[model samples]
Every structure is written in C-alpha cells, then in structure tokens.
Target chain A: MIHFFNDIARTRLTRWVFGWLFLVLLYQWSANLMISQLESPVLLRVDLDLTYWLVHLTGIGEFFRSSYFAAFSFDFFLTVLCLVAVLFPKRTIVPILTGLFFLIYCVLLNSYQCWHYHNLITLILLIVPFCFRSLKTFSILFAGLRYAVAYIYASAAIWKLVRGSVFNEGQMKWLIQHNYVDRLAVEGYELNFLENMMFQLSNYSTLSSIALIIGVAMEASFLIAFFTRKFDRHLIIIGVVFHLITAVLVDVSFLQLWILFLVFLPPDRITSSPTTWFQRQKA
Target chain B: MNFFLRDVWKQSKIVFAFFVAFILGTIWCTFSKIEITPFFLWAHYSDKQTPTGKFERIYIKVNGEILDLPKFSRATREMIQLPTEYFVQLERTDYNTNTRQLIQKKFASMMSQKSLQKMEGHLCNSKEDKNAYLYWMAKYIERVTGKRVLTLEVGTCELLFKPDGTVARENFIFVAKFSRA
Candidate 1:
C-alpha cells in the first residue's frame, strides 16, 4: 500500500479526479442548482429511501429547509472542503467530509424537487475512493466503481429486455411523442438540431424502432467491461455518446455522471509529466 | 480479479465487507423491486408504452400569461413541473386517502398498523398541503422569471397526437389556481 501510494502516477490520478469534481461543483453553483441557491426550499415529497424518511422525521432536514442561513453555511462549508481536498490531494479527511456533505445535499435536493434524478449518483460514487489514502484501497474501490457504472448500463438494458419493451415497435415513437408533447404542441417552438433529428426519426416506425434497438445495444455493450479491460476506452466513448443522445432526445442531462469516466483513465495516462512538489518528492 | 479480491480482503476487511454487502443488497433490490438508496433499480424507460392517442400535460400560467416550461433551463423546468405533477397526483388519488387504503390492503401482513399510520402521516396530502405547494410554486415562479405573479393558474391540457406526426391541444381543465393578495 505504501509503495503504491508513493508512486507519482497514483498521485497524478488523485489530483486529476478531485480537480474534475471541483469544476463540476462550480458549474452546478453557477446553474443555480447548488444548495446555497435553493433559498430554503419547502420539501414537498419524500422517497421510500429510509435515510430520506429518517432525515425528515428527525427534524434535521426540516431545520435545514426552514433556515436559509444554515443551508447557505452548509453549502459554503462543503465548497471549502472540496477546494481543500483538491489543493491537498493526499488529505483523506477532507474528501470523506466532502462525500458525506454531498450525499446529504443530493438527498435534500431530490426531496425538494419531488423527484428522483439519477444524474448525480455517479459523482457521489466517484468521491468514495478519494476518501482513502492507500492506493491499494483506492484501486479496489475504483475497480468497484467501474463495475458499478457498467452495471447501471447493463442492468438498464437487461430490464428493457426482460420487460419486453425492446420488442415493442411503437415504444420509441410513443416515448418521443409523450416526452416532447409540450414542445410539439406549441406552434413555432424551434427545435434544436438534435431535437429536430429525433422528431424526424420518430416520424417513421421502422426508423424509430431501429433507433431504439441501437440505444439498447449501446447499453448492453457495457457488459463487455466486466470481462475485459481492453475496451475501456471504447466504453468511455460509448458512455459519452449515450449521455449526449439522452440529453438531446429526452432532455435529461447526465453530465455530472460523466465524472465516472475518469475511472477508465489508466494511471500512466493521467499525467504527461509530474510538476508538483509532491510528485518531486515521490520521484 | 482473484488477486485483487485477495488484496482487498487482506488490506481492509471493512471495505471487503462493504463490497460483499453491496453486491448482495443490489441483487436483493433487483429481485424484490425495492430501492435502498446507493443500491437502486435502474429500470428507467423499461416499461412498455403504447400510444394512448391523447395525453394530459400540466400547463402553468403566471399572471394571466402562459408560461412555456420547455423554454426554461432543465433545473427550472423540473422545479416547476415535478411539484405540480405531485399536486395533480394527490388530487387524482383523493389526497392520498385512496393510496393509503390500497397500501393498507396490500401490505397489511408485512407492516404493523402503527407503522402504516406513520407512513401515512409522512405522506399526508390534504387540501391544505395542496394550497401550501401552490403558494410555494407561485413564489418560485416569480423568483425564476423575475416577474411578480399576481395570479398563478395550474391546469391540464390534453394533447392529441395525430397519425400524421402532428399534435393538437384539446380541453384545458383547471386543476388549481392561486392568487396573491
């Protein structure tokens, strides 16, 4: 474990992961999706998740929801912790606290939104390995994280197959019409390039069914990762393309989940050169 | 893989235990059709959907002006849509009384009456709850649009999907309306 931690390659990977996460935090804040910008939202719905029920029943969640100052302070503290974790990549405690606070933020946000959005799940899982200082531990957790991502996609495909949705010819056409009814109903509501393409594709049953099969096939492709690492880069590309297609067609942005792609980065490819004092010491 | 697992077991028993638990929990959740956070059912878009010909869409009008929700950002759109959908669901379920009764009949053996009551209390959705949500939504719309909302009207518009790839809006039914004094 010590030998693995002392290696410069692992240090570069650690810095890169935290650096990417810090950027995601900044983007979320600017988009008004951060906890501080929520302005003491009123909780409307809670999921069946026991943790969610406990937080609300214990009044801990209500305390944060009713007080803007407390929520803002919490967000500020979390941001500081993330920044510290990024600056000092070797510090285990900071990432651990960051992960805990971010998990709370995700649960509260979902409760307030009255819906379960799975986009941030990837970010939450990616933060786990950073909480451990040992590279051996990191590798184990990172490998597990990779499999988790693969399972998410592979399982989604399996569900579709098991439920026989993939065989339904009208499934994608109906989904497109249902999801975009508002846009389609509005007169002269301009559709973007991708939206226009999807709408056009939905016009023909054969075309729409083909698109649906292609999507399921792409998801099923992740099953290969569990068997071999040779196609990791290819899997990374497929993941990005899948998300892009979902974002444009369904209007669900899984951009935050893209952080999990960092898991595919081989340690040697993480950095071209080690320029930091920590790397120098390791060398 | 064997070497990695051996190393994980030797280096950190806690992480190894967590991995075992996670794997087992994921399988259980998959089969039992329940989500326990961290372990989730990724069955999104898996349901077989058929063409209903007509679909009901929630429409929001602020200060007598129709609000185009698709024009807003994703976060803003969700903020406006999800709670309104929840409100509509509550109305359809008769303020959750029907749903509560259904659950009571279905899971009476698994859950105690006191536990069932506790669940019902957490999900209490009376008319007052609807009003509170409407009030909050009105303010949220004002904040997002930067326009003071004198009146907020929440309604459902039935959209008819034509076979020729065109959609027409049909009956607009008022579900709820809130006015600020």
Candidate 2:
C-alpha cells in the first residue's frame, strides 16, 4: 500500500479499478433502462439496493427525478473515484472526498448487504495491477482470498451431500418425483428409465450406505485440492467438473463465481493450456 | 481540517457499519407487510327441508278397503331453517329429553298404521320437485309394496313392512346437508 502511493502503482491502480467500475456501471444502467421490472422482484443481484428506497422514504421521495440522483450515483461511482486518490495514500483506505460521497449514499440507501461476487470480483480485477506494488501484503491477501474460495467450494459440496442432496435419497428423489417438468419436457408425465433406475438403486440400503462414503470422499478431495501439492491438479480438476455439473442441474449462479477462484492460483495448478477441466489433469 | 468526516470512508468500521445497516434496512423494507383481500364463491350439494308436527292415524283405509289395522305411523314435520343438525330415530330403550319426540313419533307411527292413499309421483331430476315431494309425503302415505318413505322437516328415512313387523323394502336414510333458495 505504501509503495502504491509512490510511482509503483500510481498509474496502474487508478486506470484498472476505475475503468472496470465505469464499464460495468455503464452496462448495468443501460440494461436497467430497457427492462423496467429490473428492481421489483429484484432481477439483478445488487447489494446496495437500499439507496433506491431511501430516495422514496425521506422527504426527497422524488430523488430520482431531481434531489438525489447524482448523490445516489456517486455512492458507487465515487468508489470508482477512489482509484484516483490511490496516488495520495495518506493513511486512508480510500481518500476523504470519495469517502464523503459513500457516506451520503450509505445513509440514504441504508444498504447493509455486504459485497457479493460481482462487487468483490470486479474490485479485485480493478486493483490487481496495483497489487504488484506490495508483494508481501499482495501475496498474503491473495493467499487468504484463495483459502476463502476453497472454503466456499468445500461448504457447497458438504451442503449438497448432506442428508437431502447428492449423497442421500432426498434431493435426487425430489428431482425424479416431480412430474410437472417431465411432463413438459416429454409431452406426458412419465419418469425416464434412467431416473427411475437411479431412484430404485438409491432406495436400497446397500446403495444409500455407499453413497455416504463416496460423498465424503468427494467433499474432502475438493477441499484438499487447494492445499495438497502431490494431487493438486487431479483434485482440482475433479472439483471443477463436479462444480460444472452442479451448475447445470441445480442452476446456482453463485457457484459459477466460485469457479473463478480456482483461477487465482499459479498456472502450475493445472499445467495445461490454461483452461478446460475436461482435458486430463497434467500439472 | 475535516479529519473524521473526510477520512471516515478510510475506516473499515464506518464502511462496514454503513454497509451492514444498508443491507439490513433494505431487507426490512423488502419484507414489509403485504395486503391480502378476502374472497367468496358459491358452493355445492344442498339438502331437503320441511316443517314439524306430530300426528297419528285415526283410521285404516287401505286399497279402498276398510280394515282393522292398528299398525300406524305418526309422522312429524319440522320447517326448513338454515343449518340443521341431524335426523334422529329413537325407541323407548334410547329415549332422552332431546330424543323423546322422535321415540314417541316412531312408536305412534308404528302402532297407528291405518289408511294410506298414493298420489301423483315426482321426477327425481329437479331439486324443486324433491323438496315438494318430501313435503307432500309428510302429508299423505304411500305403500307401493316395495318402498315406505318417512320424511319430515329434519331428515328422511324409509321403513319396510311385513305382516309381522319386518322391513320389506330398502330404506334410504338421507341427512340433507344444505338448502339453497
């Protein structure tokens, strides 16, 4: 961070963070205009949505039309502005002016939800070019982030294999038992042979008992993949594959964000052409 | 120098606190009360209705022949009202304050079997005809060899007859559930 104040990161951090923030903001604003219901059931995953409401609650209810639109925009827009103040680095996480704007937006919006994937990832990408300036803090912070990502993956895998999910009779059966989707897909209500076979096999005491063993193995391996040196590539490849299948069948977008975390590691994590888990694990 | 306000965003605490507050407040507003409206619609399956009375047979004139038959039926007719409970049949063995009328009516109707004259019949399809027929049956008697109908205000059931007091026809016991105007 100290080095960032000097010539080390003055130009890089400012350009990177601000550019990403502005570009994303531009896209979101335009998209929001076209689809009017973007805010109702909350079509987008926005953490600072409360700002939209404070515009209605306080006396300045018509804030969107006049009183507070600029102020509201500045809440996030100024976070981007902090990249400019990064040059000063006067014992400030971000500069004072940017901070004041954030404060006003926070008070008005009352936004409490902490940073989710969108904010965190975008912020990281914006700051990465500057991170090289402080190798020690940069390495340690990146390591911690890497561990956090691994934890998220392990938790997800654990949650899935719990009594109701992949390891047990509950979720698989819940999926097969529902007739509505099958009916829609096939023009009539009938469980496919593959699904039925899975159901019957799952119900057997022998199969259910084995599933618990397999589940523990998968979850443990997914967690260990990040820490272990010997089988890191093998384990990570398997974890990524499992994640892809989960994304397709269960439709959880947050987990897709998780796949990005694995990319944070040194290129040696997989030793291949930098992508595609489908190919054999080389590194 | 406006140190605190100017430098507040530098404090993870203020940012943290504000961020937390903002998230929670937004959730609270999102979860606020939603209005629910009440609704009503018409229903199905109505019941039969009649009035109340207790009377016995004074004479026995069957098939236009005078006979010394005392096996009589004293029927009761209770008027139709909203939300009736149940139809009751009682004998001396089971008679109580509430059921005494049913018991007495049962015995009197049994012992006072006298004259019965069949009138014009009713079709089963129409609801109006069913109520009218049940009401009219309370006024007169009909012994069509196979069926004996005993109906009044509360409910309708049938009694079968043999010379020695045995049921000869299938008895239909109907407890009407609802009555629509």
Candidate 3:
C-alpha cells in the first residue's frame, strides 16, 4: 500500500501548483491589508499572538512590543521577498526565507483572533516549497498536502453532520432573518439588492434549506479526493461556484480555500493536455 | 540502472511510512481535544454547530454618544477584534504575563478601575486574567477611532424568532459598564 501510494504521489505538476499558491498568498495579504489597515503605531501588545512566549524567551520581545509599523513593514517586505525567492528554488536561501516569512506572517496574523484561520490553507500548502528538496521529497509533500486539504474538508463535514443544525432548514433561514436582517436594520440601512435577495431567500424557507443542504453536501464530497483522483476537477469546480455564490450573498469570501482546491487538478493533464491537443490538431 | 531503481524504492518507502503515520495521527486528533503545532487536525466551527438561535444585537455607549452594535460589530470584525468566545480566549492568553508588565512599565497611569471593570464583563475570565485584555481593548478603541472613551457601557439584546419567522421577544441584557478618568 505504501509503494502504491508513492506511485500515486509522483507528479511533474507540483511546481505549477506552487506558483498558483504563491500568487494566491499575495492576494490574501493584499486583501487583508485592504480590509484591516495596519497603520503605524499599530499596537501589538494587547492580543494573544501565541508568538509572545517565544519572543519573550529569546529576549527579542521588545522589538515586537513597540514600533507596530516596523513589525508590519518587516512582515510585508519578507512576504514580497519570499514570493520572489520562490521562483529561484535552487537557491538554499529560498527555502529558508520561505520558512522565516511564513513564521513572521503567522505571528502577525495570530495577533488578531479572527484572522488566524483566514490563511490556514496557504500555510499548509507552503510545506511543499519550504520542505521538499529532491524529487524524492515530492511524494511525501504531495501526500501531506492532499491529506491536509482532505482533512480540513472532512472535519468540516463531520462537524456539520454532528451539529444537525446544518441539516435543519432553520440554519439558513435563521442566519438570513436574524444576523443579516437585524444587523441591517440596526445599521440603519434598507435591504439593498443582495440583502433583499437574501431576505427573499429567507422568505422561501425551502430554497434556503436546499441551498444549505447542497453546500454541506459539496463540502462532504471532498472526501472523495482523498481516496481517488476521480471527480477531483469536478469537485474543484463545484467548490469555486459555491464560494462565488457565498461571496455574493453573505460578503464572505473563502478565496484562500478556493486556490488550495487547485491542488486537486491533475497536473499532467493540465501541463501536457494543451500540447497534446496541438499535436493532435497537426496530425 | 539497477542501483538507481533500488535507491528510489528505498527513499519512497521511507517517505510513504512518514506520510502514513501523519495521516493516522491527524485522524486520531480530530476526535480528541489536543493542540499540536504545524499539524492542526480539527477545523470545527463550534459556534455554528451549537446554534444559540438568538441574534446578538449589542450596543456600546462610549462617553455620552451611543455606538450602534451592528455597525460596531462590522467594524470590529474587520479591524478590531469582536467580543466573541475567540476574543475571550485571546484575552486569557495575552493577560497571563505580558499585559501586566506592559501596564506597570508604561501604561500604569492611564489605567482606570471603572473601564477595567466594564471590560471584564465582556470577557469570560477571572479578574486577574481580565485586566490586561480590558485595558488594552479600551486603549485600542481610543487609538483606532481617536475618540476619548471616558466611560463604556455594553448592552446586548437577545432577539428570538418563531418558527413562522415572526419576532418572538427582545430581551435586553446590560452586560458591562466602564469609566476611565
């Protein structure tokens, strides 16, 4: 079984996935900056970043304590440099910088509790470029990434299933009626186009219930990716559509998870299929 | 050719063994409440699972002006941390040591008992564990909005709904009060 798994993990497509993921990280960082302006004197002492213990032990806590702007600058600069360094994978510094950059970014994000989970998929995807060296390492990293993504989806599905609220028609209707409608009312804003749509969806309980069920089912279907490559591309498409719809309706975008889903694309088909088509056209 | 094949086989076996162990460990940790670094096994949104069925309409009054909870909640969600169970957890950890040291060293004079008490009610923790978070959160609001938050009051309205989607009852819960001198 181990030998069989090794064969399954071998791929020439890993590098492309690496490139795609790096691009997504840049977008994630940019979106975060746009949403939450990390201004100068952006005080860091308040929140529990989990990096405090390590910083204290190393006697370098002072550097992070004050000069909030400096911390943000260093994090952003290192992230940019790491993205550039990724293209030069042969250099030893590339991997080192990748690891260092990821650590800094994690610490910076952990300062805010809500933002901690935003880029989790990106962090997991980074293991490939940061950890693997020779071709032999590819199998291990691919296996790890595959399992990590699968586990995230599976765990979410299991959680929803156990909760039972996801299956109950009340969950979506409740969210729409209570959180959004009440929130809009308190904010003194009339229900605009999207909000009105959500309200209408809530009015038709059956539609919202069906939407919620499909969403949960789509998440649950990710388990198939772990066991077999079949339907992987189709699942990625479903995931993308699902995220796009949610982004429109709820203003919640899971772009990071969407990019990570690109890993499920069959690498050989992606890289070679175009060229194969061209050759067939000529013949 | 033979030597090359043998080396590949050996490497593959080693890598595959490690992968197997990791997969098994992640599966095990999913069911158990264990915190491990670099390998987070669970992605359970606990809040979603156990539905409270109450829409939290929280309002805060800083100084003499009233701050709307919905707008406050939105802004806080984007910029400042919202007062969720997650925020409380963050408070518990940061207040363990660094916050007190920070207050004593630099922010001692700025501290106010009224504000501290008010912030305490928002967090689900002990008095000692509460001070650092409350003080910092108060200071954070001041810095971010450039508003002098003299006194703070948090009021929560638990809005329930009937099965047919009509409003059931709005129960107002006054949670906290803080004053900074």
Candidate 4:
C-alpha cells in the first residue's frame, strides 16, 4: 500500500478535490440548503425508505428536528470537519468523518424538505474515495466512482429506452408544459428568454421531441466511457451541456453534481501545478 | 476482469468486497423498485408523460401577498414548493389513508402485520403533522424572505392552456389558511 502522505502528487490531487468539494458546500450553504439555514424543522417526511423510518423511530431524527441548537451545532461541526479535511487532505480519518456527516446531512435535508433530492447523491458518493490514504486503494476506488457516474447517466438512458418514452413525441412537450405552465400563467410576471423559449418549444411538438431525443443521446453517450477512456473529455462536455439544458428548461439544477466530472481529470493533470492546469486543458 | 479479480483482491479485499456488494445491491434495487439511498434506481423522467388538459399549480400567499416562486433561487424555490405540494397532495388523499391501504394489501404476504402497522404510522399524516409542517414552513419562509409571516395561505389551482397560446386559471382545488401567533 503506497502511503498517500509520502506521495506529493496524490496529496496534491486530494487537496484539489477537497478544495472543490468545500466550494460546492459553501455554495450550498449560501443557497440556504444548510441545516442552520433550515432552522429546526418539526415535520419529517420518512417516505417508504426503511433507513429513514429507522432514523425517525430511533429519535435521532426528532433530536435534530425538535431543537435548532442541536441541528445548528451539528451543521457547524460538519462544516469544521469538512474544513479540516480540506486543509489536511493526508488525514484519512477527516474525510471519512466528513463523508459520514455529509450522509446524515443529505438525509436530514431531504426529510425536512419533504422531497428526495437525488442530485446530492453524486456529491455524497464522490467523498468516499478521499477517505482512503492508500494510493492503490484510492486509485481503484476513484476508478469505481468514475464508472458509477457513467452508470448513472447510462442507466437513465436505458430506463428511457426500456420504458419506450424515447419514442413518445409528446413526452418533452408535456414535461415542459407541466414544469413551466404555472410560471408562464402567472399574470404580470416577466418571463425570461429561456422560459419564453421553453414555452414556445412546448407548443411545438416536433421541436420539443427533437430536444428530448438530443437529451437521450447525450445521456446515452456516457456509455462510451465504460468501453474506453479516450472519449472522457467529450463525455464531460456532454454531461455539462446536458445539465445546463435541464437547468434552463426544467428549472432543475444538477450543477452540484458537476463535481463528479473531476473524476475524468487524469490524476497527473490534477497534481500538476495550478498555473499549468489551463494550459494542459487546452493541449 | 483478470486484473480486477487478481490485483484488486490482492491489494485490498475490503475495496473488492465493497465493489461487489454495491454493484449487486444497486442491481437488486433497480430491478425491485426500491431505493436504499446511494443505491438509487436512476429511473428519473423515464415514464411517459401526457397532457391532462390541466396542470395543477400550488400557490402560496404570505402576508396577503402571493409568492412568485420563479423569482427565487432554485434551492429556495424547491424548499417552499416541494413541502407545500406534498402537503396538498396528502390532504387530497386524506393524509395517505388510501396509500397505506394499498401498501398493506400489496405487502401483506411479504411483511408482518406489526411491521406493516409501524410503517403505516410513520408514513401516514395527521392533523398534528399538518400543524408542525405549517409552523416549520412559516419559519422557513420568514428566514428566507426576511418577513414575519402573519398569515399564510396555501392553495392549488388548475391551469389550462388556451387555444390562443395563453394560460388561464381554471378552478381552485382547495385553499388552507393558517396564522402565526
């Protein structure tokens, strides 16, 4: 087992990963997605998830929801842990603890919001490879994570294919109408350019169908990563474009999941000097 | 495949085991329609959608002023909209009694009666749940908008796309009001 602390390259890459993860956390905090900002929510939506039910039954959920002090304290502790992990990326325990706390945060936030916010799944899982300090172990786990991200997109495309929704001409039109009709209908409310374009597209079935097919094709392209790493850069571009289109048209922001794209960056490139990073990308 | 089985197993048995377990668990969850977090089905937007002639819209009025949800940030907007929509949906279904019954009937052979009852208790909504949700929602609104919510009204209305490329509100399903003391 190669010690990551002794390897400057792996250490630098780990720090780079943690730095971006911290920035994502800071953005989430600013967006009021943090527990302190949520205050102490009284209601917990357990849904059908057995793990959630266990949390509710064990009084752990109640402990967080019933006391703002407890919730805020946990949030502060989690932030501190994440900061420590970012600073000392060589410490194996810090990332492990941060990952565990982040899991609890994801579950609690979803319970409070009464919705299963799955976009955070990428962020949560991406923290796992950093928990290992063994260079070989970290590399293998990181490779697994890369495959997992590709699987997410590829499986989504497969689902659409299996469910026969890919062939439905009205699918995209209905989705746009369902998402934007209320906003467009609100009198005196100004519609932005993207919203206007989406509304116009909703009225035209052919245009919307073409957009949906393009989306499916983009998702399907992730399958290429499983076969070869040569097209990883192209996959990253497609992933970003896909998420951007969804954000603009459906108002769903999966930008946080973009952190997973870091996996596509070769470890050597990540470990390279920061000033040369842009130059390397251009090359 | 040979490299994975030989080298990965030799280097780290734990990582090898974890990969195997996660792959199997994800496959099972995907096929069984169960999501045990981290092992999601990833079947989002997979089902076909068709126009129902009307779109149901949730409207929230805080301190007698209706909220333009599109004006807020995505996170804030979801924080406000998701719970309100869920609450209204539960109200329509009588706090999920219908859902509970269906679950009980479907899983009768799979789960014990006591376990099913406990699940029902956790899943079902009550008047107290509604009150708690309202209180938390009011506080969240206050925190986000920096306005003390004196009165909050949540309602749902149907929106119809007219022939002339315009949308009109058809009729309100219901409206619930609450006041913070």
lDDT of each: 0.76, 0.32, 0.53, 0.77
Clash pairs, model 3 backbone = B114-B179, B115-B179
lDDT of 2 by residue, B79-119 (tens): 11101111122112131322233224444455433211010
Structural similarity of chain A in candidate 3, as TM-score: 0.75
lDDT of 4 at A226: 71
lDDT agreement of model 1 with the native: 0.76
Q: Give interface RMSD, per candidate.
A: 3.1, 29.7, 7.9, 3.2
List ranges where model 4 is wrong by over 4 Å.
A1-6, A274-283, B1-7, B97-124
- Model 3 over residues A94-131: C-alpha lDDT tens digits? 55666665555554444333334544424545455345
Q: Please estimate how well model 3 matches the true structure, expressed as its whole-model Cα lDDT.
A: 0.53
Q: What is the TM-score of each candidate against the true structure?
A: 0.88, 0.34, 0.69, 0.89
Give per-candidate clash totals. 0, 24, 2, 0
In the range B10-72, model 4's lDDT, one tens digit per residue, is 777988899889889899888888777778778888898887658878888889877778777
Could you give the fnat of all candidates in order? 0.47, 0.00, 0.12, 0.59
Q: Top TM-score: which candidate number?
A: 4
Q: Specify the highest-DockQ model's number.
A: 4
Of models 1 and 2, which has the larger lDDT?
1
> What is the TM-score (0 to 1) of candidate 4?
0.89
By TM-score, how accurate is candidate 3? 0.69
